[model samples]
Target: MKFNKFSKCLQIGLIAIPSAFAMSLTYAQDAGTRVAVVNSEKVFNESNLAKAMQTRLQNEFTKRQNDLRDSAEKIKTAAEKLDRDSAVMNEAERVRRQRELADQDRELQRKQREFTEDLNQRTFEERAKIAEKANLVLRQIAEQRKLDVIMQEAAFVSPKADITDDVIKALNSQK
Candidate 1:
């Protein structure tokens, strides 16, 4: 399987739930406990910079795949031509073709390795930056809303409430 399918995105749920009877944030409340919800997925999906980074990574992978395929095709064509003419071909020509094929194989392997490492690094770095920024904005929004607690929408079983737009607004304003 490709690394992407196996590598799930990192999820950080920042929840400041009031400590119940003893929960820290709970106050002398006859009033219901205040809750704030932020949808991290939504924020990630909406970020323009994140989207661009994803597209760029995909394009890089595509280019590598195309180049590898082209190289393989050239090697295959060379082999076929050699097979047809082998009886009459000089030893030097045969050796040259074999050497070229070996070089191409080595180059393809090196490129695939480079792409895997580079793509994974870029993905991690970009995601970390985006997640950090989104969290910063979410925290600011929760403060502005006077929320007693803030939680990631997904982590909440029923998501008692949603302030995703508030978080998004805060994120937008941040820029």
Candidate 2:
């Protein structure tokens, strides 16, 4: 009984493999011949538009970032002073200073969290803008060259199939 089951399974597997291959061949024949690949990392790094956007974002956020740094420094200074002077104070004065330090530390932490969230949100927005612009250029290149498909970050794309330079050129031309 086991041998019969094994034979049946082997036959089914053999039939299915051939059928799958035939279907794939038919689909390949119907598909367009032109294909292209894009290196997304290269596009992001080399594009003039990306560079300009990064610079703009950095400038826009620099003041807030500096403020955060200043606040952090102030908190550090306060903590250091509390550590140095606590031993010299009376119990009530020491406790009061500790409480004040804790409050200041909590406030700084809250501000730091807010700063991080805002920075991350703005960075994402700027990156999305750069990606959208790069995609537009990619589409333009694909359409101009009659590409059936354009894959990004393929593991093994041939140099001939890489259209990243064209997309970067298109982006730079807009500048």
Candidate 3:
């Protein structure tokens, strides 16, 4: 009967699908999938290059930071003096000093904004450089170790699968 033939075909198809899946799974296991995990935070923090870069940025920005600090101190001193002298100061003198204080405060704020923007930009640029260098080293390590996949961030990675130390070593070696 046609119904019987159709049932037989359906049974054969069902069996074939499971067999195909089993064969593919067997093939994949035999092919040896190698996976690795890298802690990018570790690589960035522990690398010699990153340390050097940080030191360089700190040194480069130190003078500007000091200048800003000095400006802030001057503004604070001026404001304190105005507050103390206002009781004795003439109307004209008090008004002039108040205006000067306001101007200085505005200037300080503008400088602070500029300094923050500049520092942020420089930090972003340097961090990008560090990341680029880390990625290059990561790729080299992966290729050398014959890794099929290297994860940057993971919730949990066994010590055996973590290649971050090797990556840090490579980064340090580049120093």
Q: Which candidate number maximizes lDDT?
A: 3
lDDT of 1 by residue, 100-140 (tens): 87887788778878878887898888888888888777667
Q: What TM-score does structure 2 among the candidates reach?
A: 0.78
lDDT of 2 by residue, 60-175 (tens): 88898898788888878978987898888899998887888788778878988987898789878877887898889888888888887899888798899999998888889985
Residue lDDT tens for model 3, 1-175: 9999999999999999999999987886799978899988887677887788789889989999999999999999989988998999999999999999899889989999999998999888988998998889878978898888898889899999999888888888885
Q: After TM-score superposition, what is the CA distance of residue 18 in candidate 2 from its true location, in Å?
A: 9.7
TM-scores for every predicted model = 0.58, 0.78, 0.78
Report how far residue 94 has shifted in candidate 1, in Å. Answer: 6.1
Name the candidate, 1 or 2, with the larger lDDT value.
2
Clashes of 3: 0
Model 1 stretches astray by more than 4 angstroms: 1-31, 55-69, 79-103, 153-160
